[model samples]
Target: MKKLFTTDFKQRCINLMLHEQHTVAETSKIMNVSISALQRWKVQYIKEKQGITPVKPAITAEQREIQRLRTEVEQLRSDNALLKKVSAFFLDKH
Candidate 1:
């Protein structure tokens, strides 16, 4: 059976993947959708914005490595922020 979704809902999903930096697979899983469905939605969303449909690009190993590094950097930044907050709290106590 084919399910009908609103344009607003599709835009929100695309926003999650684009603006929020969520991976397509992550957004798909979170939204209870298939990755391919999300990909198609993304393409439609782009076309709506730019008036042109972009070709799907293949994922390369270097792209994967860059994504992995970006994730790691975000994690490290979060850990550093937590450590700073803890340090400030202890220093205030002393």
Candidate 2:
């Protein structure tokens, strides 16, 4: 039968490997889990603590939109400035 660990238990396992300085192998053995599972949990915990969650996918979409808007705005500004310059040059000539 497979064992299902709770959130608290999963955090505890990660803490043992991190704060307690236990190796992944040791934590897996002590927690009765696979080493791969412990390693995966540790990676997720570290990423979460570093503010790099899977939620970044949403931020990525926002960032892409912001970049696109910025590019469009810059192009518009450049076109407007060029038109103004042309208008001023024609006014001076006339």
Candidate 3:
């Protein structure tokens, strides 16, 4: 059976490798996980750190605020565009 790791466990493994400056092979051996899994976790870790992916529940307050603001801005922009279209339609009908 394949072992399933929790997000916390995956993050801990990635952090151990990164913060302790351990190579992927070393980390894999120490963590008892596959080297390929470690490599993939490292890539995912970097992407999450760079905000390229939606972070898990461990996201900081600042990141949460930024995400909320971004969502609000997108919604506002969509609403503005819709209003503009409606205005244009009304004006054309007059």
Give per-residue CA lDDT, model 3, range 1-94, as digits (tens).
8887876677778878888888888888888999888887787667667766454432334445666788899999999999999999999999
Candidate 3, pairs of clashing residues: none
How accurate locally, in lDDT, is each candidate?
0.73, 0.73, 0.76
Q: Measured by TM-score, how close is model 1 to the native structure?
A: 0.52
Error in Å for residue 73 of model 2 = 30
Residue range 1-94, candidate 2, lDDT tens digits: 8776675788789889888999999998898999987887777667665555443221233444555666799999999999999999999998
The full ranking of all candidates by lDDT, starting with the best, is 3, 2, 1
lDDT winner: 3
- Cα misplacement distance, residue 58 of candidate 3 (Å): 8.6
TM-score of each: 0.52, 0.53, 0.55
lDDT of 1 by residue, 1-94 (tens): 9877765677678889999999999998888888888898777556545544234321333433555666799999999999999999999999
lDDT of candidate 1 at residue 18, scale 0 to 100: 94
Candidates sorted by TM-score, best first: 3, 2, 1
